[model samples]
Target: MEFHSQQPIHPTIRKCIQHLDVIKADDKTKQIVYMYMESLLRERDLIAASKQEPIESQIHN
Candidate 1:
């Protein structure tokens, strides 16, 4: 279920996750963190997919 080991994230994003005081964050704050992580995963997947495709195909599209 871990997406982190398979994908790389920006240093700032890592720092934010590392520094987050889970015990102190309210429900809303935790939800925001979850959303951010989801977005980051989607962006990483999109970038990886783009790299896998041929440049000619991309140019023609």
Candidate 2:
């Protein structure tokens, strides 16, 4: 699963992710942090997407 493409993240969050390398942690740990941030982005995107206007067409397709 590609995490970065999941959704648009806030600038502050992106900055934090970039700083992950500054932390004294292994690759696996850094990945875990990224995944957590990615999840937050997904949640944010989901909500934003839901707030957008829906299709006017009645067709399910």
User: Per-residue lDDT of 4-53 in model 2, one digit per residue for the tens?
Assistant: 56557667766766676567566677678777877887898888886774
Span of 10 residues, lowest total lDDT, candidate 2? 1-10
Superposed by TM-score, candidate 2 places the C-alpha of residue 51 at a distance from the truth, in angstroms, of 1.5
TM-scores of the candidates in the order shown: 0.55, 0.55
TM-score of 2: 0.55
lDDT of 2: 0.68
Candidate 1 vs. true structure, TM-score: 0.55
Please give the RMSD to the true structure for each candidate, in Å. Answer: 5.2, 5.7
* Best TM-score among the predictions, by candidate number: 1
